[model samples]
Target: MRRTTRLTAAVLAFLSAPVAQALDTQTGPVRIDRIAAGFTDPWSFGFLPGGGVLVTEKGGRLWYVAGGSARQIDGLPDSVPDGQGGLLDLLIPRDFGRTRQIYLTFSKAQGAGSGTALASGRLDTEAGRIENLRVIFEMTPGSSGGRHFGSRLAEGADGKIYMSIGERGDRPAAQDLSRHNGSIVRLNRDGTVPDDNPFIGDEGAEPAIWSYGHRNPQGMAVDATGQLWVNEHGAQGGDEVNRIRRGANYGWPVIAYGRHYSGQKIGEGTTRPGMEQPEFYWDPSIAPSGMVFHSGSGHAPWRGNAFVGSLKFDYVARLAGDPLREVERISSPETARVRDVREGPAGGLWFLSEDDGALYRMVPE
Candidate 1:
């Protein structure tokens, strides 16, 4: 039998949390609460400073969800919703209360080409619109086609923002530092280059690049100790979870654990000098995306564990241990294509489903 677990009235105004159905999980019995639905390719979401939630849809739309209701947020700029482009990731800066600013990753047009771009704007809650919208960063040498737009945002404690850019189906582009493709970028909160960035002073190099040679890095997070990690998608197989190292090369085209979609071999057999290997990898390609490292008392049993949403596997993988193993597979009985997994502000767990376009929360039953 299912039951409703109600939070205090104060908490209700924040998330509108309601009791849900119990399910058997590896850790224990838990309940899942449905947040808001009726989304069209909801790519990412984050908490608003005012206890609401902002969801970015791939079709150039943003929805403000709160109190069991949703409102369409206006002022979203034109973004191409192609193969893998559109409004991707959204983040509320830590200083949101003071700044009332939020960041977004979207695909911007460049001639006949498009590339991932980052923008920030002031959220005018009273008017339900964004003001002063500006694109702060754009991947250069924009390429045609939208097979890979690797866009995820994570803010460092230093108040700097980090983002991932895909190679746009151009394998060789990842090896070139002059172009922004296939790289992790660091920028000042205002979209200016960080002076200490690895390539800042180098001639003919992309100054925003913090790391290179990645293939569609879709998820990034910073742990409590300030360590950064990324979950990347592999071509046909070889999805990887890696620890981000400054100025390091991930050896995408040169070395890989997976093969080409045409059944051809890839790279120089997965070992190369000066190339960083993944801390963990999936051979058959789970098509990993959203990720978060859980720690805190709200979900005590999940503390110190890492959760990753699997696009191809239709489940969420709970990974633990230094070597990083998938300890549990949290799957919705109805086969949810998990797109994003996040650690809620209250220490609970939340995820977005692409299959049904619904938001769900996992909590103690």
Candidate 2:
């Protein structure tokens, strides 16, 4: 992989001027700047080791963006671009400098339908291509629909790979241990199941399952304390953020704070025995997506807090406090339909807006 700091003239021109006005919030004044634009349905992005970034579009395009110029990186795996399925989250591991290894999640064709799959490969920036690409894990393909593929990737503190897979629109399937749908799977970097996984010896249970009963958890992050947290979509009004526990059931269709789209009550009531409760929830459903726990000292006031993008509300939610609550709604025209939010390697917060088809950076003014 090669590194380049050369900036294209057009990008240099855009950066020469302020992209947007400074917005004051609880964290003080901050500026949101456009890093790159013209993406077609960008879903996620990751910062490269030396410089630049790798962005994924839902239409199966992987882009190498730097210095305000963008180029498509070849060698992407075969992915189905049907509805919500396509090239999704990207992960640039902590050891990318030495290993040059990166991970990605996409919807793969499984017989008649498609399911979420995880793949790993080496990024050759000099050639603008991926090499030795191989699928590490794939869900059992049965359900068929374009909605709720819940593909998100996170590197756990323990060095394991954590991925979220949605129920594929089959409500009851979230509770089925035999299926990989509607659950978070913990695996080794090479896509093998860890021996200490929650359901290792349980008969009929998929060994990769870390926790089950999630409706469509699109947002996941590990806190400073190494705790895993996930924000899942609710039926109508019950979007929830839960502190993920090993072997715990998160109660999706069974017990939810929201009602069905038809305004009918969901399975059972809100509180149910043997199921976990959300640490925080949104009554009107913000349609949350990518998530990241802010670290380092980029914005002193925002350190150690969590930032979640609201796809429905066109804002980034800052959640803090002991029990966790929304501290502020960071909004700007650049936040329209936020799909992913990640903390930059050096500092500051970066996000992708699906509506604008652009990438942005948020920094303290």
RMSD of each: 5.0, 2.9
Cα TM-score per model = 0.94, 0.96
**TM-score of candidate 1 versus the correct structure, residues matched by position:** 0.94
Tens digits of per-residue lDDT for model 2, 50-84:
79999899989888877657667889889999898
- Per-residue lDDT tens digits of candidate 1, residues 33-74? 777766778899999765888888898888777766566778
Write down the lDDT that model 2 would get: 0.90
| Global lDDT scores for all candidate models | 0.85, 0.90
Per-model tally of clashing residue pairs: 2, 0
Model 1 CA deviation exceeding 4 Å by range: 1-20
RMSD of 2: 2.9
Best candidate, TM-score-wise? 2
